[model samples]
Target: MKKLLIASALLAASSIQQAHAWGQTGHRITGAIAEQYLSEEAKAAIAALLPNESLAEASTYADEMRSNPEEFWQKEAGPYHYVTVPKGETYKEHKHAPEQGDAYTALKKFSKIVKDDTAPLSERQRALRFIVHIIGDLHQPLHAGDGTDKGGNDFKLEFFWEKSNLHRVWDSGLLDRRQLSYTEWTEWLSEKITPEQAAKWNTTDPLIYITESATIRDTIYPEGDRLGWDYLYQHLPTAKVRLQEGGVRIAAHLNELFAK
Candidate 1:
């Protein structure tokens, strides 16, 4: 029992250290919103795979697994959370080794697993969780990083008088500042998502999502190191929209994958 407690504490510490994308609350918000938009067919399929788990419950699985001591989780999966596209270059123009996977490649790989009927149930479940998580990650503009700065993780700054990096600020600082539960965020964002907005955002193209994020990322770096209410006031709306889009796109991708 003591060993188990120690292991749990280690995992918690690892999660905190490796957090590079939307934090738990942000990911859960996207998953909850995705659940609201799922088609009946998609809903049934997801229910079969996940059983008792809702998308919101499954959303953080990929990030949580980062603490696993396995090589795949420790190494290979590290690059799956974000993509690096250099300034003035599109993802298409940026070449990377096939083995050195990025978010774009990882998304395609897991997406295929999720849609493959013959894949093992556990594999499919993991793929589903990754899909939920990665979509949320892609929406966090910093995750669509420039070639430098490690997705803004290296771009250190002070946020609300606290020492934080640009990536961390986008990941949790802005959203957490609101102090809303994931459910409340879901409800708040859902009310603002019109049918037309949903229709437009329900795009399954990962390239579009990545490009949109990169475009936002390029513009978000503050002129100076210190960021307070003004920075939050300027960027929070964009962050909310990205979360909304991530949720809508997750449902769209699942609906297409499970379509009869």
Candidate 2:
């Protein structure tokens, strides 16, 4: 009975991944990697906000909130997970936030809440979970959409034998196939970055991060709708780098938030 319950929960979780930000493992991997680069001060600050949880564990809260019964989580939180940048336009050119805020706008708002000592602790806690998740969201190329394609959600394709869409492929199809737990993936990717690499990738500006993703998104569409081993081979490195940068930048942002 216990095994059946666990399998059922896993099945339910899998169904939701196709429509959301990076699947659970991808977000957790970003969170875990960010854990490695955090300062002692940042870690302590996070502990105060989260009590028993680490940033890695808190990383999926925003996504998980979708399952929540609250109206804000079910409806208003949709736009906070991604931003659409039409082709030939920069985020600045496309700067208007819908009634529902986009990830870039939400990042700016949450950063202030997390850093403000004057804010209610409860509010700050909510903000910090969002801060961790949205950073990972901004790093996924498809999350920075090209306006027309629904971020490639409308682009139908077959990933191996399974019917899927481009957005879902980037969200989890590639990373899930590797079968590494988030911690293992984080450790593996974290080792590949050197001091120089870290310095080059760490940036506080959210817009720059969005731009990097937007540029990559434009270049990554396959000529054919069929994606298999070769397609994964060509783009997997790109995904790894984005994940690496997302982790490093999450740490950088947290360090700045908590710096005394």
Top-scoring candidate (TM-score): 1
- Candidate 2 at residue 169, lDDT? 94
Q: Write model 2 residue lDDT over 84-109, tens digit each, in one string.
A: 88888999997646787889889989
Q: Which candidate is the best by lDDT?
A: 1
Residue 153, model 1, lDDT: 79
Which residue runs does candidate 1 get wrong by more than 4 Å?
Answer: 1-17
Question: What is the Å distance of residue 112 in model 2 from its true position?
Answer: 1.4
lDDT of 1 at 16: 41
TM-score of each: 0.92, 0.90
In terms of lDDT, model 1 sits at 0.89
lDDT of 1 by residue, 18-87 (tens): 9567899999999999998899999999999999999999999988887788888876787788877788
